[model samples]
Target: MLFLTRRRKVQREGIDYEQIDKEWDWDHFLILQAFVGATVFFLFPSLLHGLPLWDLRGLMVAMVVHVGVSEPLFYWAHRLFHKGYLFEHYHSLHHSSKVLQCFTAGFATPLEHLGMCGVMAAPILGATLMGFGSLGLVYGYILFFDFMRCMGHCNVEVFSSRLFESLPFLRYIVYTPSYHSLHHMEQDSNFCLFMPLFDALWGTLNNKSWQLQKDVSSGKNDQVPDFVFLAHVVDVSFSAHSPFLFRSYSSMPYTFKLILLPLWPCIFIVMLVMWAWSKTFLVSFYKIRGLLHQTWVVPRYGFQYFLPFAKDGINDQIELAILRADKMGIKVLSLAALNKNEALNGGGTLFVNKHPNLKVRVVHGNTLTAAVILNEIPANVKEVFMTGATSKLGRAIALYLCRKKIRVMMLTLSTERFLKIQREAAPEHQEYLVQVTKYQAAQNCKTWIVGKWLTPREQRWAPPGTHFHQFVVPPILSFRRDCTYGRLAAMRLPKDVQGLSVCEYTLDRGVVHACHAGGVVHSLEGWTHHEVGAIDVDRIDVVWRAALKNGLKPV
Candidate 1:
C-alpha cells in the first residue's frame, strides 16, 4: 500500500457478490407475476375495446414510452424515495432485506409498491391502447424490460457483452448490474432503468456509482439498523404472501380488540415521545447528520464550506469580511471549483488538479461543497485557498484573513469547454474549480480571480504593478501512469522550502516567492482512487462548546 504510509486514507469497498446466487430463479413466481401483469394489461384493452380508437399503434407507443421514458423517470423518483421522510416512512422496506430472494423481487407494502407500479404502468398502457401494435418492437420492449427488472433485483453481477452495452452508441446506453447495483449499495445517485440514455443525458444517472459492491466486515454489517437486516433475511426466505392475506376476520370484535390493544398503547407512547422530541433539540440530530448526510462523505467538493467569500461577489465579499478568515503540496492545485451542470457552461475561473495536496471545507447554502478532496494537496500546496465552492462555510475565516490584508483568490467551479480552449492549459485543479452559473441554481461552477491566493509576504515585497502568480497547476501524469513517483515526490519535499505553492505575490509591488507542497519539498515548482469495507476518511473534526450550561457562548 504505497498510498497508506504513516498517513491514513478513507477505505473503499467494491462489489461483494457472495450474497447473490447467479443461478437462482423463481420461475413459478415469475410466471405468476407475469400472469397478473398481463391480466391487467389485457383487461385495459378489453375494457376499451369498444372505444373509437382501439388499435395496436397505441400499444407500440405505450411500450416505447414505458421503456424509454417511464423507466428513467422512476429512477429519479426512486432516488428521492431513498432519502429523508420517504426512506423512513416508505421505501426502506424494499431494501430491508439486503439479501434479496427471487420471490421478493416485487414484494413491498401493497399500497406503496403496488400503487407505484400501477402508476408507472398507466401512462404506457394509455399510450399503447391509443396507437401501438408493432409486434417485434412491442415484444422487444416487454422482454427487455422484464429481464432487466428481474436481474436488477438479483444479486448476480454479469459482464454480458450484450448489444446495448457492447455496441458504441448502445454501449453506454444500457443499464447493467455494473450500472444499477449502486441502487442497493449506498443508495444514492445511480438512478436509471435498463436504459441509461435519459438518465445519462440529464447528468443524473450514476454510472460510476454502479461498480460491484465489496462486503464490509460482517461485524460492520451488524451495526446497521436491524429492520433493514431482517428485511434481507426475509426476502430470501419468504415469498410475497400478503402480510395479512391469510388472517381472516374469524376474530370477533372483542378478540380483535384484545390482539391489537397492546399495540395501541405502545404506538401512542411512541407518538407522544416523537412529538416531544420534535419540539425540543433532544433528538440525535448530530448522529443523524453523520449517519444520513451522504454529502458529508463526498471528498472532492466537500470543502466548499470553508472558503471565504467563496461565491459572494465583490460587494458580498466586503459584507462577508464584516463576517470572517482562511490546497496543495508542491503538487499545487493550480485551480479547482464546483460546477453545477445546468448553467455556466462557458467557463470563468481556473481550478487546479493533478496534484497531491488540498485542504478543503464544506460550502453551505447552494455553493460547491460536495466533498473534501484533499488527498495529495499536502504533496503540493503552497499558495492555498482555505476555501473552495464546497467550503463556502469558511467564508468568515477567509474574510478575516482578507481584512488582515490577505488577497484570497475567488475561483469559479470548473468546466470541460473552457478548459479545452485555455491558452496555457490549467492542469486539473483549475478544471475542478469552475462552477456552473445559472438562474434557479446560481452556481453551475466556480470562477476564481487571480488575486485570491496572494500571500502576505507577496503583498509587501518589490515595486508596484509587477505580476506575482500563485499556484498555477503545471501539467502532470495521471494516477494509472505515475502513482509511485507522485507519492515519493511528496516525500522528497525540500527541507529548505517554506512551502511548495506558498507564494507572496505583491503585484502592487514585486516579490516572487514560491511555496512548496510540504512547506518546502525544496520545490521551485510542482506537481496527484480507492476500495473495500465502509472505508471512511476521518470526518472533519469540529469543536463545539456546550451552550452557557457548558460555559460556552455563541459568538
Candidate 2:
C-alpha cells in the first residue's frame, strides 16, 4: 500500500539508492542473525521448559514492564548515544541517512544494534523472570517490538492525524513514521523506542511532529512540478513495472515476467478500470538540480494508440493533462511515447492549437528523438536504410542525414511522401534520398534506422553485421543473431538528479527517454517556445547540444 500511494510518504524526498547499496545487506544480515539467535536461545528446553504455551497474565505483565521499565531504559540509552563520543562514533551512522525506508530500521552500527537488541529483550526477560512467563508472551512481545520498529522507520505515514485527534492518548503510546523521521532529521529530538511518551516525559519530543504528520498525510507538502513528462502505459505485463507496484522491478529495463503471468487477469481488469474511469495521475516524481520533475500517466495503453475508436479518448486525456500542467504552473510538459503520435494529436499540436495561451510549453520532443537517432548513425558510412521513413521522426532523420550528403534509402510505398521529405533537404543533397518499396533494398546497407516494427521474415532482408537503430514504440524484436539492435532513443540524466528511485519504463537508472530529456533541456535552457507540431530539422542539433551542455548524455 505504501508503494501504491504517494501522499503517505513522510519525506517527499526519494530513498538514497547509493546508501542502500552500501548498507542494506549488512544491516539486514545483522538483524536476521540477531532474530535467529534469539529464537534459537529461546527454543532451549532448559530455559523455557516450564513456561506455559499460553498466558494472558504474563502478556499483561510484559506490557506493564515495557511501559515502566523498557521505555525509560531505552530512552535514556538513546539520549546518551546522541551526546559526545557515542554519537560521533556509533549513533551517527544510523542518522547519516537523510532519507529513511523499512531497511533503515536496522541500518545501525554493530554496537548500536547490540544496544537496541538489549532494549528489545528487556520486556521479555522481565516477564520471564516474574515466573509468569509463557511461550506466547515471549514470541508475541518480540514480534510486536520488531513490527513497531519497522513501522516507525518505514518513512510512510500510515496513520492519519485524526486517529490521534480522536484517541489522543494513543499518540503518546506509539511513535509514528513521521515522528521518527523528525528524530532522524533533527537528530536531537524525538528520541524514544516505539513510544513518544518517554520523549514527552524527558522533554525531547519535537513539537512539530504532529503538524508535520498532519501535513504529510494530507499531502499538503507535495509541491507542483516544474516539468511534467506526460507518459502512457505500454501493456498489461509492463503495467506491473509501475513504481507504485514495485521499486526494484521499475528500476530496471522491462522484460516479460513469468511470475506476472498468474496476475495477468487481475492486471487486465485494472487496465480496463483505468481506461474506463481514470484520468491523468502522478506515477512518480524526482528532482533535477532542485527543480521538481513529475511523470503523469495518461491511463491508456500503447496498443490503444492504433485503435480507431480509442484515438479521441486518448487525445482527450492528453489535452486534459496538458491543460492541467499549464494550470499547475508547470514550465514544460513533454509528451512521451505515443502521447505525441502525429496521427492522434499531430505531435501535440492539437493541444497547443486548442489552448493558444498555455503557459506550459507542450513539447513533442521529437527533435531530440530525431537528433539521438541521427547522431547514432556511423558518420563515415555514406548510405543507410530508413523505415517508417515518412513519419515525424523519420522525415526529420531522412532530411537531416541527406543534408550531410549521406545516401538514405527511405523504405516507403508513398512516393508523394518520400518526395515531400526529400524536397526539404538542400538541392545539392536531395539526390541522396532514394525511395524503396521493400526491405530487400536494404540488403547491402550496414546501418539501418528503424522507426517501424519489422517481422522476423522482413528482418532477414538485412545483411550480416547490420545494426538496427530504432525509435519505434514496443521496440522491434531482434530476429537476426548476426546483427545488432539499438534501443529506443534515451539520454542519461544529469548527475545532480535527486530523489529518482524509480526508472522511466525500461530505461536504466539515471537514463530517461529522449523526449523526457528534451523537456528537461527545454526547462534548463528556459526556452519559452512550445515544441509542438513538426520537428524542426534545424533545431535538432541545437537541442542535442543544449542537452549535452545541461549534462544529459545520450544512452
Candidate 3:
C-alpha cells in the first residue's frame, strides 16, 4: 500500500484510503496530535513506578500496548464515526467530500479527534496514578504509530517524483500522498485508522506493502456485495468459514513482518518453521523415493477393496476406476481402509502376477493420519482418484494425501446409494455429498424402478433423471420437495448450495482422476496428472510395470 500511495495520479483503494475520509480541522487535528503526543510522552514514563514494565511480561505488555489499547479503540471509534447522528456532528466533515484530493488528509471530526487523545489518556493517567514511569509498550507504540499517522496523513508526498520512480524502498519508509487517496473515494475502502495490519488482514487494504507490485496490482475498489459482506462477518465468528476469499496471510504485509517481528519473534519463528516444512517434501523427494522399499495403494469404492489383499478382483468400481485411470495416465497408491498393517505394495493383481516393471506395494490404510495430513504431502504423487467414501473419510484421506504434497481427484457419486455403497466399502471418505434420493425419490434410485421409469426398456442405461452422465462436468444439486425424504432423512444443507457448508479440495498436479461417468481422461490431462493409466489386466500388469521399472510411467 505504501508503495502505490507514493504515486501522483488519483486511484481508488490505493494506500491513500484515509485521504478520502471526512476532513478534520487542521488546527484541531494538529492540536490533538500534538496534545496526545505530548500527554502520552510526558505521562507514560510515570507508570513504571520508577521501574520498567517491560521486565515481567514483555509480550503481555505489548499485547496490552497494541491489542489491549489501540485495537479496541480503533474498532469502536470507527464504529462511532459510521454511526448516523454523531457522524453528522463531527465525522461528516471528514467524509464530506468523498472524492478526496491529496490535501484532504489529516481530516477527522473533533469528537473523533477525542478518540485519538484516548490513546494516551489511559496510559498517562494510569501510569501517574500507579506511581510508575510510563513503561508500557502501548505508550511507545502509540507514539511511533501515531507519529506515522500524522506523517502519513500529511497531504504532501515526501519524496521527489524522480526519486520515487527510481528508489522503491522510499515508499516503505513513508506513507505517500497516494496512500490515503483510496480511503476518501471508496466507501468500504481504507478503515485502518492508524494501523495497516487490520486492513491487510481483512482484505480491505488499498496499497501494496512493497512499491514494486503497485502498478501491476495495488489498485483497490473495496466495495462488496451484501452476501460477501455478510460472509465476512460470519467468517470472523467461524474458523471453517475463514476459507480466505481474500487471504493475505499466504502473502503477508511488511508491517506484520517488520514492525511486529521485533516484539513477536515467536510468530516470526512459526512462519519460518512452516516455510521449511512446506518445502521439506519437495527438497527430499528423491530421499523419500529411495526409502521407497514399498509402494502404497489406496483402493477405491465399487472395488470392494479388501484384505486377503487382492482377494476380491479388487472392487468392480475400483477396477473400473483403475481402467479409467489407465486410459488417462494416472498412477496412485490404493490404501485399504480395513487394513492398518498392509504395505503399499501388498496384494492386488499388480503384486502377485508381477509385471517386471510394474511393482505393487500395499500401505496401511490409515497411513494418512490426521496429523500427517495436517502438515505435508509426499511429492511423488502424480494424481489421486478417490470414490465412494464417507464425507469425513474422503476429507481425511484428501487431507492426508494433500499434505504428502499430492493432489487428489476426490471422485464423487451424487446419489446416497452410490455413496452408501462407497461408505460400506471404504466407509471413511470426506468432502461433499448431495443425496440425489432426497432430491428426487427413493424409487428414483432403485435400479428396477429406474428401469421401469425409462420410456423404452432398451434406453434404460442411465434413465433420464438419475443419470450420472449429466453431472460429469460440474455437480449441480436439484431437489424436489415431494420426492425428497423427510427432513430427518433429508441430507442437511443450506437452501442454496452456495450457502451450504462448501469446502473445496484442490487437486494436485500430475494426478489424473477417472470418475465413474467418464471425462476422467479430460480432467487428468487438463490438470497434468502424473500417474500412468493402465487399462486391461495386461496393461495393468505389463505396461505399468515396464514404466515403473524404467523409472518413468505414462502418468
Candidate 4:
C-alpha cells in the first residue's frame, strides 16, 4: 500500500514533498539499524530463555500492558529528551529530517534508540517479572510497536473524516499519521507515540494537529483557493550572516553546494533581470489550509533586490507587493517591517497619495500593535522606558500610557524632537512625569517599550529585569535568563476569521502585532482604504475581537 501510494505521489499533509529526496539517505540508514538491532535483541534474549509460547489470555494481557504501561513510559522519556541541551545534542539529529517517511520512523541516535527500546519492552519485561511472560506475546508486542512507529511516520493519512465525524471522541485518543507529522513540524507538540492521551492531558498537543488531520482526512488536497497572498522578503544578502543559513548550506550535498555557493552573484543577476522586466514576479511561496480558511502567499523580492544597501529597489519592492496583492484580488495587503517603512513615507500617507487607484488597501498596523503591547503590560507597571519616542508608533504609545497616568521616560536620538513632543503634550500631561532624555538614563524601570531597531551593543546594554514589549523585527533581545520579552504578535484569533493561518509574525502564544493583525482585521472587515500612521486607541477592541473571532480566545 505504501509503495503504491508513493508511486502515485499521493498528497502528504504538512510536508515539504521535495525534502523527501534530501532526507532519503539518513532515513534509509536508520531503517537498517532498527531491523538489525531488533533482530539481535530478539535472537539473543530468547536464546537464553528458550520459548515460552503464549495462550490467548496471555497475549491479551501483553497487549493491554503495551498500551497501558509501555506507552506512558515512552511519553515521559520522549518529553525528557526535549529538555534543553539534551534536544540540542542528541534528539535534534532526528529532527534534522523535516519530511518523514516509514524509513524515518526509528531515525534516532543510539542513545535515543536504546531509551525507546527499553520503554517499548517494559510491557514484556513486566510480564516476565510477574511470571506469566510468553515469547509469542513478546514477539507480537515488538511487531506492534514497530508497525505503529512506521505508520506514524508514513506520509499517508489513513484515518478518514467519517471515522472521526461518526466517533468524535476518538479524535482525542487516536494518534494518526497526520498527528505525528504535526509533531515533526511543531517539535513541542504531540509527544505520545501510540496514543494522544498524555499529550492531551499534559497540554502538549499541537494547535494544528486536529485541523491538519481533519483537512487531510476530509480529502482536502494541495489545491489552493483564490486567496490574498502575504509575506516579507528574506533578503539573502543580509541573511548571509545568519547562522541558520550557513548551517543549512553546509548540510547540503556538493551538487547543492555548487549551486548555492554562488547564490549572491546569481541573485544579483536575477535582480537585474527582474529590474529589466520592470514588473513584479509573483512567485507562489506556499499554500496553507485550515478548517475555516485556505490561502496562497507570495513574497515580492529577489534576494539581492531587498538587501538594505539596495535602497533604490525598496520602493519597487513595495509597489510589487501592493500590485501583486491587487492583481490577486487581495482585499488587504499588510506591509511588514522594512516594507512598511519604505511605503507611505513611514506613515502610509505617501503610498495613498502615490497610488490612489489601487484596489488593495495598504495598512501600517500601528494601532493593534500598540494595543497588543499595552495589553501585555502589567497594571502595576507604573513607569515605562521607551525608545523611538518621536516616531508615530512611539508617540501613540506615549500618549496612551500617559493617559493611563503612567510615568514615561521617553528616549530618542534627538533632544529637539523630544522637547517638542513634551511641549505639545495635553494640558493634564503638563504636570505628569513625562520626562525626555537622549540616553539610556532610565534605570529601575521594569517595563520597556522598544519601538526602534537597536544595535547588538545597545541590546546587550538594556537593563536586567526589563520586560520588553518588542516591536522590532529580528527581535533585539536574546532569550536572556534575567529578562522577559513579549514579541509583538496576533494571538487567539476569533472563529469569524475564515480559516486564517499566520505562519510567520506570531509567538507560540498566538499574539501578533497590530501591524500584521491589523491587515488581517481589514481583510476580515472588507475595509479597503489606507490605515496608516497612528491608529486610534479605540480601534484596539475591534482588532482584538477580529483576532478572537478568527480563533484567538473562544467567545
> Where does model 1 exceed 4 Å of error?
1-59, 133-144, 161-166, 207-555
Query: How many pairs of residues collide in model 3?
Result: 99
* TM-scores of all predicted structures: 0.29, 0.84, 0.27, 0.50
Question: Each model's RMSD to truth, in Å?
Answer: 26.2, 4.0, 24.3, 16.0
Local error of candidate 4 at residue 402 (angstroms): 1.2
The CA lDDT of each predicted structure is 0.31, 0.84, 0.34, 0.61
Runs in model 2 lying further than 4 Å from the true structure: 1-10, 26-65, 83-90, 109-147, 154-171, 214-220, 252-284, 304-313, 423-429
**Tens digits of per-residue lDDT for model 1, 38-123:** 78758765633444334556656676677665766676667667779977886776665444333335545444554445545554
Q: Candidate 4: TM-score? A: 0.50
So what's the TM-score on candidate 1? Answer: 0.29
Q: Which is the leading candidate under TM-score?
A: 2
Q: Which 10 consecutive positions of candidate 2 have the poorest summed lDDT?
A: 20-29
lDDT of 3 by residue, 385-404 (tens): 33322333343444444334
Which one wins by TM-score: 1 or 4?
4
Query: What lDDT score goes with residue 492 in model 4?
Result: 46
Worst 10 residues of 3 by lDDT: 225-234
What ranges in model 4 sit over 4 Å off? Answer: 1-229, 235-309, 342-344, 419-425, 430-435, 455-463, 492-502, 505-514, 553-555
